[model samples]
Target: MTNTNRASIKIGGGVNGSKVEGGKIRTEKSTSSTENNVDIIIDKDVTNSAEIIGGEIHVSSDLKAEIQELLNELAKNPITRKEAVAIEVIKEHINDNPSLKQRLLSALKAGGTEALKAIFNHPVVSVSVETVKGFLEAS
Candidate 1:
């Protein structure tokens, strides 16, 4: 002979639902008493990433000469479409930021090497480098 206790415990609740034996269940979500009353803290890096490149350079003279030769080469020949697109993207970025323009002017006044260094690893510079390299290898 076997005996089975046939009991079904149906625990069904939505959101913050609860069940109890002859007790109240919220069945609703509770919101914070203090809504929209909060403070947000933000820590921003004000230092320019451009400065990092200049900090790493030990021989400015050699860098300046290399930059000058690159410019001379570009000036002496017609640029490929890839190079033109890269330059356009860079120009748009510089035009959008007045502070960048001022910083660029200052760097140029100090020396072309400093100016070159400022944008050394920038997205625009990366694009330009890859585009130029691709063109050179193709020719």
Candidate 2:
């Protein structure tokens, strides 16, 4: 679900939590001094699929850096062959691995797009994966 979704989601006031299922994300208008917000908690079930998918989807640090060295690669660059492979892997993994998808999505947001790219570009992947794995497990 995309928080960008502008639908006015009418709901009961006493929500311990609110979340969108599947591809839909909900964003709510704010009444407090704080800004409007939407939150998506990564699901418990999606973790394994995300890891296997993310692993198969690797690209070289060189390729990732070349893409990031530019200005706003996400908006401007067509998906590179390198990225395409990863995307396909992710798509397949996410098909049934919602938990992993949520965890990865959580990571991507914990650090926004650029930081996410830098992490992906990390040269030492085993350590990087373990770091991410440990962080996820610890949490």
Candidate 3:
């Protein structure tokens, strides 16, 4: 039911010893393949489960101020976590190409946190952020 490789994760109706090239049966897994790869999936009948939460504004009042402060600081900084290896990759790209760094910063300023988080899971761009804000509406 879980794939620890992080290369891909799958939650099949039934568990298999190993994963193959990926056949049918509605995979609930995380795949890093940019070409039609998978990140998160649910096999339940529920449809239209995607939702978004505007940063800082989507959290509870009790934790709102703290989360906002965190967001403001992180929005203009570098990351430092082994799990966030993607950031290293991004840093490399930015080092080699400062223009890209500017471009991404510009995009972030324009799109705000929501878009940046989406880009992380998205293939075309690779940027991830913490302090996730769950959608106000149910997914």
Candidate 4:
């Protein structure tokens, strides 16, 4: 033989069916006492999330700086064969790492067409830029 026990929880007045609009959640309440008015507000910027290739991609600042350094190195005039190979390796790494690719795409989006041109003009780096372009086009 076995015994069964049950319990129920009941919640009282609260904000119901609240929806986020323009990156904000707002709720207001008032009591019989004039001083008892209550207000709740939350604010956030969702625009950046919309701009990113993937929903809210997060890359560390250090990684972003390091990638920028690599791009700057590639952009330098009279690049050597070793540097070209290194660029290829970087491309491979970007392809292998989704975060890095997202970071690259974010940088490109931030910099716009001029940045795209700069990357595309470099024969060694253009391959990776093309890959990024394909992602942009697909999205």
Greater lDDT among 3 and 4 belongs to 4
lDDT of 4 by residue, 1-139 (tens): 2111122222233334443222111111222111111122334333323331212212234544555556657656444224556556566667777876775576456443323333333334333455446654454
Q: In candidate 2, residue 16 scores what lDDT?
A: 36
Candidate 1: regions farther than 4 A off: 1-81, 121-139
Q: Rate the local accuracy (lDDT) of all candidates.
A: 0.33, 0.34, 0.34, 0.41
All models, RMSD in angstroms: 28.1, 16.1, 16.4, 21.4
Candidates 1 and 3: which is better by lDDT?
Answer: 3
lDDT of 1: 0.33
TM-score of each: 0.28, 0.26, 0.30, 0.31
Model 3: lDDT to the true structure? 0.34
> Sort by lDDT, best first: what order?
4, 2, 3, 1
> What's model 2's TM-score?
0.26
Local distance difference test, candidate 2: 0.34
* Model 2 per-residue lDDT tens digits across residues 1-139: 1122122223333333333322222211233111112333443443332421111122233333332333233334345224444444334544455565464556445433322344344222212334433434444
**Deviation in Å, model 3, residue 119 alpha carbon:** 1.8
lDDT per residue as tens, model 1, 47-130? 332121111112233333433344444445445224565466445555566665455444344433323332332222234534
